[model samples]
Target: MSGLSIPIHPITHNPTEAWEQIKPTQRVIKLNVKTPTTPQNENMLRFVCMSDTHCLTSHLQFEIPDGDVFVHAGDFTRCGSAIEIEEFNSWIGSLPHKHKVVIAGNHELSFDPKFTCGPAARQQHKNAHTGGGLINEIPDLGIERAKLKAAVEAENTVNLITNATYLQDEPLTICGIKLYGTPWQPEFCNWAFNLPRGKQCLDKWDAIPAETDVLITHTPPVGHGDLCCTGVRAGCVELLSTVQSRVKPKYHVFGHIHEGYGVTSDGKIIFINASTCNINYVPVNPPIVFDVPIPPGFSK
Candidate 1:
């Protein structure tokens, strides 16, 4: 990371036009960065992204194309099992990318409880789900004590990948850029980072500090990279609005809707839906790569 100074996209123009050769369907494993490969430049950088892996260890172990940073959108596990979480984390931390950032998908319930409840929340939810019955008041299942115990066990016991483990609501800096991962998703049955529409998820994006170089999430925004053949948009509308309007990251990477694999750009932001798994739940998609120039003075 010390001597690595290269401008991934060097032309003084729009990146989409410069990298138009890249396709949404064609499989590409590498993107070459020009001579300057470090973050000292004013504006240039490269990032690698993959999403919806669902615990495909082979894809995780296979050599990922080179880049300055690696971003995983979400769904690292099939059921957020302790085994799957460790397996994915171990594999993700090993990539050549200088930094690795990830968010929890609907599958990893242990870390993201926004969409889940401990015994108390789960019980309260169960009561409501059972009959939508009116309750004198929502009972706090009081499962925190037990939940914390389980969470600690997972983080400590599960094997670690690169000494970097899953971080919640925390920011990690790589090279000179800032990276953040939010595991929240749209409202759905008990799932990881689940948030309701409107105020629920928007509140999450408000915490992202400005100049965030990269944002990682499990679900894509409504229109950009999120689409379903079911004639419905299954992504988070609030996240889309907040990220595109507020964070304005150089890259927004996500996966969950497998069919959304590909690249979409709003002229300023490059959206990569890097799902390692396909619609049929197969690890067919390859890692997508991009070169981003790190402007001089980019923070650590």
Candidate 2:
């Protein structure tokens, strides 16, 4: 990703009017520091974050820096095959970070039974019933689906990634920081963690714990880092509302739409779309790194 300097919201005498002019569309600048470094007397937790690797770890051009924690927001595999999952797990195991947090992306079909067995089977049944009609219109995997199902059952049922804590709609605290990870996004191309817009999606987001300090999701909140190359904004509006109004996580990290790889902030929340791949699916985008100070008087 380009090290493009974003426009920061300047502090003004008129606080109310200044905030009103700071729209989510306005890009908030990222720290220009290449590596996370601690200043005097600050207990900063350095995080090395990358997402949407899509099984392209071998092609990565840059080195992942050492940090207190490593976060893979999602899309560790191109397809959610058991072999791919194991490979990603092995790679995660090799990383030097002490705490590694991973969340599933929309592509991780086996992680969600609703997509693989429940809805997929039901849709297949419906297609057969309706003289070859299609739901979601994603191509039938046929034998591939059968193979993937078996692989998921055998390898991914109990322990998918041995080295990292994989979370789905769950919160985990590491070194005094309360973090929540969720894979759900607004329905798009019918992938995993997809819920319909409005109530369905909003209800899922409503599950976010109010005290979350770090929010890891696979999709960018609307109007933040979700602008597609084609000019269409593919983000969850409801997610943005939830993040801004209620959850208000200090840092929100995600990746799915590869084109939307960068950092932005809306005063309170720093949104990082750390998509590791480019639009062409090359794992060339650099891992975004940053530091968040451990909250005062907090214990692990």
Candidate 3:
């Protein structure tokens, strides 16, 4: 079926209900990555996915399984401070994965131009009077406010992550699989990379390449892994429309709503919400792993 034919309206509020509604029509595969698994074909590439570490990689209690590719959906830092980025980079460098892909989350304010020097920054500046300064506007997150200010003002804050490929509306090919990463999501608490719902969000999704094999975003698509404990759906409706109808990637990986961590599918596309941290800000969730057959002419 074509993506355009899929019905995305009357957005489902409960993820379970949404899954049930499509269960019969779609083939869903829920894997337990925490347990030992049999070896797969050498021609396939294993992907280990995690997100929302929130600068707490050191607190992780479980061992990250080995994989050929490591994909971090987003939210690796608490406040996107320089120290946090450096620590994350250092930690990722220690991983055994041959290819690591990362994208900024809403918390990575320093990596987002719209939040640092655009209208959002101006708004923060205007509100600084109540809090003292831009640095003061942000709550104390262990990092000093003065240092955060410097990090935010620094050019090319994305460069701080040298260990992994940081993607922001860009594409990178790994083992012949074309993967595209985007960070924009619906406006949430005036966070970074936020755009108003509807056209603004749709425009960002439209930028995704149709030939993309793997799609990564900071936010989940509607009715997938986007249900919040508050009984609200936080995923992007426009993103779902774009994914189902246009991109149609083999895998759609994301993590923003910490509670919505799992794997779901629409029969056509596999949706994985690899949220490493739970709703309580604890790093208890395990990394999700999946394998994709190496495309023709591609060697791992």
Candidate 4:
């Protein structure tokens, strides 16, 4: 399925089988969407956030839960491949939510992320060194993480998803609340969507607006819900700084770290890491649900 592509129906009243086929065995969370006729009377709009589903279509049978909008941070597919994307899109479209926001993670390499034409893959290592891509040297023992990450993504083993096909990256208003999303993850040993620290990842974080009412990110900020297998926080320090300083959205939802499938808050901002899969890729974390107040400035 190198160039796999599947068509997806928009969010609608699709049959249960539509989602069942994609997901074979998994717990499902049934969510209820607000009625269109209902007024934005509630001070807060209900929001449900989930991520790292890894193509767990079986989970869909449980119902997506109720909320003003449905948000997917990233890693919606196992390999992020075209086939996986279509599977995800089709299932997502079946949901009857007012709006849906999504973004691509390093694993969700929707397009040809491999830098077959980039300088890194073709970079030369003289001094008795043979041909090696740009990932040859890094803190993770110079394992050429970038090239490996790309290879795995392109392989579509988990199905490649990417920034190109990502769900939503710009400021969006739903039920009178502002929302934004970013899919970049921290530097890992050659994983997809990994952004280097300092300016590399910070640049993308800078793109987020300060007044965003709801922020959807694929990965968590440093010290928030970002923990690795070693129990060390693998989140981007710069992202943590940027999000706290420059981008102070009311609610930030993400789910790259499955181990930390819980919610945290900064008194002002609500952080949710609804990882349906555990750190070991088990469907443990349930979908996170909460209601956000709607300021008078926003509209439906």
Candidate 5:
């Protein structure tokens, strides 16, 4: 599967037009800084974000900027193997951030129950009801089902991530900020934690806490930072709806489309596509850093 090619589809919504139509009334600051620096205010908490490393942490060209919190938005591994998970955990453990949060991406095949042990896995088997027909006609791309099951049975891959706080449709608090992380995205090349574009994807987005201050997802909300180099938008439409209409977090962090790396805002919420890797799989992008003012009552 080294040279695997996934089909790309053009996104129906035009992000530029969408942003222009609902222009933010208030001035939203865009934080696409080059160097990492301490927060100017004592009450501000700095966040260092990176995603889509894909087992290339060692090849990063720049030092990970120091901050109060570190957020990894997924795709830390190429295939989510046990060795890859262990190496990622070790690399994360070396980071100095006091609070680190992580979530799975499509590449974390072993972490997703649906792909490892549920319907997706069953699709690999021959369908007896259809007279020995195969459910998925795509050739097996070398990911052995037996190995995945064996790895899961040996030990849960989630437990291997002991260094950072892993979230899956879960929430965690750091310095009074409510952060929720989810891995689901619109189905892309039938990877892990993927669901259909409509209701299934919406169902996952619906579980995000309404009071979340920061939203971390593997897939970018459509139009924010989801454009691929091939001129297609790889973002989830329902996710964009959920974020703007309901969650409305102060910052939305994500990285899946490697080419879509940067920061954008819609007058209200800030969106960050912190993909450390470029489209060529090189760790050329710098980690995104931002400062969030701590709530008056909250102490660091």
Candidate 6:
């Protein structure tokens, strides 16, 4: 009745008594209506995952399929500088995915002061290029660190990237699925999210909720997807224990060791190293895609 064009049924009564005397024929009418079907994507959530873009968005040689959600494990910029972060943010904003989730990595020095202040790790991994701010090779390392810290404080470095949902030791729920994201990883090259190997890393992993459906971390758990070309296991053992024993997420997505871009499963869980870039710092790897069915009895 509110200006909507809906079907209406009409009835009329005969006033004369002769109407009843006369034989009347019955007539029936049926109205057919169509109900719209829901979109196929509405029934399932598709996640397109990638990581370690390293300020090489435009150079990507692969196509990212349309998806409901996009997950970036981190290291989107070469040095997490204002320019780098801004460019990354623009690229993230341009993605067609409905929801985008991201976390900071060791290379994102502007996001973490401790990483920028610490001396560079003795070993530098492949494609770990240095940009502005804290450069360990400089003769005046202290002065460089101080200068970087001053820039971060003055400009609020993290504020530069605001296009995606940034997570740091946080959990979020989307489309009836629980997601927890943290950037922390085993201490390496004194980068952001680096924590000492033993209890420190364990304490960080402990914060992950037991019901996390999708776990997004910059570093993979030990022996899962943390293999480097140098024949070293850069993952944290405590993190692996926590994931296998307690968290047990349906999908553990990460990317830091570029050489470890692939997928693995441990009977119960699926581990995806969705590194979009390769060891040579080339953004040639394809984005990983997976579908998660809607939970039973779940409604929007």
Q: Give lDDT: candidate 5, residue 172.
A: 93
- Stretches of model 1 off by over 4 angstroms after superposition: 1-44, 59-63, 114-165, 298-300
Candidate 5's TM-score? 0.83
**Model 6 alpha-carbon miss at residue 261, Å:** 0.5
Q: lDDT tens digits, residues 69-115, model 5? A: 99999999876789889999999999999999999998787788764
Taking the tens digit of each residue's C-alpha lDDT, what string does model 6 give over 1-300?
Answer: 012221111110111222222214211122121221345456677788999998898999977777788999999976667777888889899998889999988778667755333343212211134544334433332335544333334356677668889988899888888899999887677666677666666677778888888999998865666678977667655665577668878888999989988887766778888888888988988888777777876733
lDDT of 6 at 131: 40
CA lDDT scores, all candidates in order: 0.61, 0.74, 0.81, 0.60, 0.78, 0.71
Lowest summed lDDT over 10 consecutive residues: which window, candidate 6?
6-15
15-79, model 4: which lDDT tens digit per residue?
A: 12323333343222223433234444456676667888887867543456766677788877754
Error of 4 at 114 (Å): 5.3
Clashing pairs in 3: 3-245
lDDT tens per residue, model 3, 1-300: 133433344434343455455446545456434533867567998899999999899999899988888999999987687788899999999999999999989889788886478775677667655765555654555666666566676666788899999999999999899999999988776667877766677777877888999999999987778888987778776687788777889999999999989988776888999999999999998998888889999897
What TM-score does each of the candidates earn?
0.69, 0.81, 0.85, 0.69, 0.83, 0.75
Compared to the true structure, candidate 2 yields what TM-score? 0.81
Task: State the displacement of the C-alpha of residue 28, model 5, in Å, after optimal TM-score superposition.
Answer: 11
Of candidate 4, the 10-residue stretch with the lowest lDDT total is 1-10
Worst 10 residues of 2 by lDDT: 1-10
Compared with the true structure, what per-residue lDDT tens digits does model 2 show for residues 173-208? 986898999998877667667777666766677888
- Rate residue 9 of model 3 by lDDT: 41
TM-score of candidate 3 versus the correct structure, residues matched by position: 0.85
lDDT, residue 96, candidate 4? 70
